[model samples]
Target: MASNMGIQIGNAWFQRKINLRPQHRGVHLVTEEILRQVPELLQFSVGLCHIQILHTSASLALNESWDPDVRDDMEMMLNKIIPEDMPYRHSCEGPDDMPAHVKACFLGSSLSIPITDGKLALGTWQGVWLCEHRNNAGSRRRGFILIAKMASPRNQSRRPFTVCIEGNIGSGKTTFLNNFKQFNNTMVLQEPVELWRNVEGMNLLDLMYKDPGRYACLFQSYVQLTMLQLHTMKSPLPYKIMERSVYSARCFIENMKRTNVLKEVEATVLEKWYDWCINHALIETDLIVYLRTTPDIVYKRMRARARQEENLVSLEYLEQVHQIHEDWLYHRTLFDVPAPVIILDADQSMEEMFVQFEKCKTRIFERCRQSERESRLLTSPVSSPKIGAASE
Candidate 1:
């Protein structure tokens, strides 16, 4: 058999809002100065780096770097073209602010540079130019957010990176999602517990557990509706971490039928709803993290923290629920999980579990970026091999 063609994969996207040291009022060659500071860029094969100046006064652009006079001449021409004396209306912050805006308009406040084989894909003579429009006679302040994403060939549209956190009840799903909330490029969509509890002031979970046969169908329906909402939620950022999904609801109701808590009729109705909704859901998860724990551990945690809704939860019920999760997620006895599943040993101390959470968290983000880079490599336009200095 022919060997599968290998692709370079690693971290693919990184965004950091950093301040470059202030420079005197002039143009400067900051390609090396800025790149050396970003180690994440060194991991990918080919991508694009975006530098955006947050401040209106400063600007970023690509220009001649081989000759020192080129930058000096450019700065001189900028002063001549947008002369400070020309403007008078918005001079509140002295003469600099208004003229600064004008100079910035020509130079621009953002630039995107292509990366080839982990280095800036630019002409031998090209370099990154940071133009300081304000008169920073002494004080130089940094003001820019540099974002680099693996660029696909001709822009093959890719969905946002997504993850579904899977675990039995009280397995620290919420806490795990909270850990990733610090990422500016990541969004967390939690389970709609509040909506389920106060549906017309009727505690669905509490009522369902008290009378499983009576409320099983109603509970499953609400779960299916809410999980669908989570599945179809628009991610505000490039990365989304969903607490639970429609598949879990399906498994839960399936177990309810197996144990006779939900009759065959109720289970059939719930399964049909789940199958249609899950198959029709627009967004699919790229990865699933299964927080695996024994029923005893889960039950201990559940009862000790006695939420009124879960008061009816018993060790016998927990065992069956745990088995259902294993059968669906690991054994594949039920529906097939579409994404890769990573089983985490969740029966550890809180401190130890958190440490594991960080490891899992890091791996998920790293893999997502690597996948993006690989996709870009496949469709990217053919180009001559890059040579010479690092940024060239």
Candidate 2:
């Protein structure tokens, strides 16, 4: 079943979600929307862009852009072909709802485009279209997950590559780091929870979880300070694997502020500090590997692990934290993220997690190895030979 297809390949990958507001039943140009969202696309000299709309009721398409009639014709054709009036088993939602799903299946929810000279290799007449199939009752927010692969620059091969681990509590971040530790030339820096707990043997982490209002400000200050320290710490090895980063601190603090755990004055002060630290370049990250799992799953794992700080933690608190992370990480317009994210579904067992590691290991090492080589070349400094000097 193998076809003799030969082509040059790229090793680096980037992925993120692009959000969009609701639109009426029609085809709308979304190429510019995507371009504006993912500025990283400009970094690639040559690559491929794959966009998958993560919903079943809408779809993606590529067609004429200059003519307005094309969109109207597309809608007209779809409506005619899959008439909403047709009787169906799943019509309890609405007349349009069932037809929307049918049209989505026919049109497809994914699109692929080539990248040339850091631009989508689209034709003059062709452009990406978001075909919203639903009739407007209120609003329908939609999103497309974009994954791009590009050739890594040779110069970056020698820089210190850093990877930040992100996940809900009890989503196996520590365990993942432990397994990652076995790799040579890797520096694994764990979360500062232990330090937060043992500061003067008072256990600020436990106090904050048990009684947030009493110790919210104080705990947040120590958490930010320690996380900033971890962020600024230099890694001698090529692979700098960190358990958590300043971004996690932002999510937790934002949750406290949102839930009224931190008062107005306290929220303002702590958020100002966070903005200052981030603006001053306190940390840098090459990539973020998100250990994605549901809040319910994490709660189960947390209860099973029975960590002291987590012993008194309620399911409600865990749900808030999960929502905060979803907002901060995916909804970047609300709160910007420093690096690109790769979401690994962590709902599976430990053995499956290792398999996931193998999948990502190649790209992780590519980034790290590039840095090591670049460092050696820059530091070793070789002189060029003069013309005809060897003969002389």
Candidate 3:
């Protein structure tokens, strides 16, 4: 069963795949075709739009839009640089097949352009060109990913202030979320660990721990998909809190890369997807609450909880995970920090942890109120002073 997979944010993010009508092999201007297919581009004021061709025989480039001679010269130059008359071994598809692939590689397969004032910020003389290398190439498919930033009206309901709780395995994250359950107007999203435990009655978590070399890539891929689902979910409350986020998922994948569980190609593909999601998706994080704890403390807690899949987990592994989290969230030297962080000592006992949660609650609510005030100020209309009446 074929299924559609991708992310979209109300007017902020847009993604689509469209097939261009067949054209004779040449460098043809395609800016109009693209704009016609993706009218959503008009909704963005300030953003980036990325277009990637799905085929290797064709490519995309930004060049002269006004004169036809410029495009003709470009195609003439490409053919000269890589001629079809040359004898090539990989000619099963035709004489132009190998040269087409090479031309596509030389010119590249993707182009990213900035968007301003709900339109492509192309220079007056620049336009998108579709370089067709083959003689009778059919319709070509291109994927578009667009992201924008828009201000909300003062009376409009804004997206909830989101918080992501990050910690090592069994770092009292579940306990912390439970404490927030009593508060009204707040939505708490826990990690989908249960789904990991039984994916169609197969324990992927157990397989990963038992044989990481074989299952790490598979496990992490599914994890990323699930985390994306969580990140894009809508909340009806004023505040949204999640146990772990897509950013934290990257930390685990990085750990797998460092441990040699994931190969370089596998890691690269995952990292690229992660980068795209972070940059283009609508996964917003206003604050990150890091439950900082020692490996020994968490290991003890994990053992006490006695989860079946975690029986093989060791303190050594937990230490590595701890350091990765520290490098990412605390040191701020690894990937980008999506939001402000609030570090808490999670080594306390249950009673003490509750007290800590109480203190953190106050800060969280205060930030929420402050954000509301700022949003009002930004969305409220500015009034001009009366010319004759007020002179303070």
Residue 194, model 3: lDDT of 53
lDDT of 1 by residue, 216-294 (tens): 8998898888677666644335677888888787778878878888877777788788778766768588999998889
lDDT of 3 by residue, 250-367 (tens): 9899888888889999999889888888888889989999999999999999999898889899898999999999999899898889899999999999899888999999999999
lDDT of 2 by residue, 127-164 (tens): 99999988872344344578888864222233358899
Worst 10 residues of 2 by lDDT: 1-10
Model 3 TM-score relative to the real fold = 0.60
Better of 2 and 3 by lDDT: 3
Local error of candidate 3 at residue 329 (angstroms): 1.8
Better of 1 and 3 by TM-score: 3
lDDT of 3: 0.80
CA lDDT of each candidate? 0.76, 0.77, 0.80
Could you arrange the candidates by TM-score from highest to lowest?
A: 3, 1, 2
Give the local distance difference test score of model 2. Answer: 0.77
RMSD of each: 18.4, 19.4, 18.1
Return the lDDT, model 2, position 164.
93
lDDT of 1: 0.76
* Residue runs of model 3 more than 4 Å from their true location after superposition: 1-156, 387-392
